[model samples]
Target: MLTQTRNVEEKLYFNRFVVDAGRPHITVRPHERPSAELRSLTHMCPAGCYSQNEAGQVEIATDGCLECGTCRIVTARTGEVEWNYPRGGFGILYKFG
Candidate 1:
């Protein structure tokens, strides 16, 4: 049987992006407590940028974000994330057609 074997991370790596290192377009609520859904971001993010720190708080690294909006939707229940599109020339840039 023939089948394709490309993962989300692999595809993200191929795509180009201009990350605003100085400014993250997304941020998890530092004041609010973490919920299951928020914690899920660690695995849900295609870029694998969201993760738990030593303190067990959800931390997001927006650099590798695919701009897929998954985090915003997943964490909608708590509204613990502040998400916004990167500047006009920033963020993910899909090169493959």
Candidate 2:
């Protein structure tokens, strides 16, 4: 048996993302401004989709989202995030088992 290890970035390269134009499955609610909960997403999102702007505001770009549900899980009770699964055939397609 042979064993191989790859870092997250390297492993991600084998996956494909089918993004739905003008339709994002995850978004930061408009009324939810920057806060501890929002800021926490910047560190918690494994895909690095959340970031802090110069004005100390949290923003999200769903282009490379892994669709892992981390954001939803973290803010499930806050209503700060609106999350749904992308339309059929428009999301992550894992190439590796």
Candidate 2 lDDT over 1-97, as tens digits, reads: 9999898788999988888999988888764366677789999998889998887767788987888888888887777888998899998888775
For candidate 1, write residues 1-97 as lDDT tens digits.
9976777666656888798878889988885469999999899887888989888888988876788999999989889899999988999899653
- Candidate 2: segments with Cα more than 4 A from true spot: 1-3
lDDT (CA) for every model shown?
0.85, 0.84
Total clashing pairs for each candidate: 0, 0
| Alpha carbon deviation, residue 92, candidate 2 (Å) | 0.8
Clash count, predicted structure 2: 0
* TM-score, cand. 2: 0.85
